[model samples]
Target: MRRTAISTTVLALTFLAVPATAQAQTQYTGTNAPIKVTLTVQGPDGLLFKGKVRTKGHDVTPATGGTHTCDGTNAGANPSPVPTPTAALDDAARVNGFTWDGTWYASFDDYLVESVKGVKSDATAYWNISVNGTSIPVGGCQFKLNAKDTVAFTWTTL
Candidate 1:
């Protein structure tokens, strides 16, 4: 009984010594405390992917989405407003996106999808983004996301 009491006291002190910021970090860690969301990728032929993916809110990462041909490398990249781990294009890319091609447009400080799942955007047709069935004014990388939100990418024409 005496040994157990001493061990418990030490454990309690160790936990108390930890800083508040460090304990809170787990909530901000994208993979550690993830948020669930819906992702829908609609191709010209049909739907490419639809499922739930885990994501997190974060401080805006400039020019971030992936490490592909056109991801997170713009000279004019700027961080978006901090909301809970944003589930924009970066989340889709992390979850179920494939073979994506996008451009980090410094003019808009956003990312535009040029191709995804082998489908390319043409002069007439392009990939558009909608959150919960409403079209977004900003690029996919700039759009914010919330839990249970449905992010849809549809291939369409002007």
Candidate 2:
């Protein structure tokens, strides 16, 4: 009878301990943290620029929405922001010597697309930004990033 009592007590304690262990596992440990986002620049001809930049981990929260700030600019479309792609290029500038003249943003080492010309003028290719194959409403500065998000810049002709 005593042995049975001891076994019963151990079983009950084991059951109780299982819940605690499970709860600890569920708590966020920041694993798989977003270290960088993939940046792909493409043109009508073919792939132009391909690179990766470390994510700043700044304002990664989705709740911040349109409130995130970048280089003294706010989110939303007064002029339509391409924040994610722009931000990636900015990061690239610091890390990879990338340069931009208006819509043209690329690393000089590769000089893949040469210069992206014009904005609203006819017969000019413009740079378009997208994340995971979907265009974002905001620009790079305001665009929040998750771990390993893909940011793409495509040059399209008018």
Candidate 3:
């Protein structure tokens, strides 16, 4: 009879402990955590342009020209052609701690430039969305016509 009572008590304690353990496990599911990120882009003359981008949802913004703003969704429209550098060596120093070569040029369109190491030209440009720094690989966003002479691109977190 004593053994039976002890077994019963042990079973009850185990049942009580199970729920507490399960509850602790559920708290770490991480379903409500926010994602963090950083973005960077390089231009001519060591001009490093950086922006804080969020990945919560879709967002769109206007494009910029070298000097003055342009019209229509396509900012590349007849933009004042800036002289492209003869060699990558004559470009500005890499911005945001990344080293790059060659003269950088800005288009009427919005693009991102990614930094790489070892390669002669460690900078590459994306059409719509570009990865500028070392961070999560967010996909590229495309440019759309917002209004007359206004174009925008939207990036979203997946």
Candidate 4:
């Protein structure tokens, strides 16, 4: 068999085996145990929150600035988000020993973490969320975390 053809077949099989994200359940099935992960919140001032946190849930308030475009343009009209488990970065960030704030963006169906500790996103800087040192296209609240995932919210600029 040709090398290119063999690789193509293998790649196709891998895609077929991987379940869709919306339908897939995590490895820890049927268990409500908190997803413990390392969380870091770095603002312009300095590191605000750094420690392990629980992704099970939190009593903190939901992001309240209506919505924002991917480019950080606020949508102006705040819509009350339906209560649900963001169950990802937002869930884990609820702890880490710092007060966090964010706003829900319907455009992405995720929460854009706006402020950490006392530092807030402004015309000059914003919170950039990364997992394992890589920036992802989706919002933190949408990105599922595995155990030991290094979730960092670093202050960034345009």
lDDT of 2 by residue, 1-158 (tens): 65345433432332234444433432232322335778876757777567778745232211112323332123222223222445565566546654443321111101112233221212344455667887544334434545577987776553
Which one wins on lDDT? 1
lDDT of each: 0.51, 0.44, 0.24, 0.49
Candidate 4 residue lDDT tens string, 13-122? 32234345522322222223456667777778777767776664223354453432221111211122211123433454444344567655355444656666668776
lDDT of 1 by residue, 26-66 (tens): 22211224557787889888988787777653433323244
RMSD value for candidate 1: 20.3
User: Model 3, which residues run further than 4 Å from truth?
Assistant: 1-34, 50-53, 64-139, 142-158
Question: What clash count goes with each model?
Answer: 5, 8, 7, 1
lDDT of 3 by residue, 1-158 (tens): 65345433432332234454432322221121222334333333332434332232122221221221112122232122221110011121222343432211233132232222222222122122222221212112211111111111112121
* Ranking of predictions according to lDDT: 1, 4, 2, 3
Candidate with best TM-score: 1
Q: Identify the superior model by TM-score, candidate 1 or candidate 2.
A: 1
Number of the candidate with higher lDDT, 2 or 3: 2
Comparing 3 and 4 on lDDT, the stronger one: 4
- lDDT at 131 for candidate 4? 71
Which sections of candidate 2 miss by over 4 Å?
Answer: 1-34, 57-73, 76-83, 103-123
Candidate 1 lDDT (Cα, 0 to 1) = 0.51
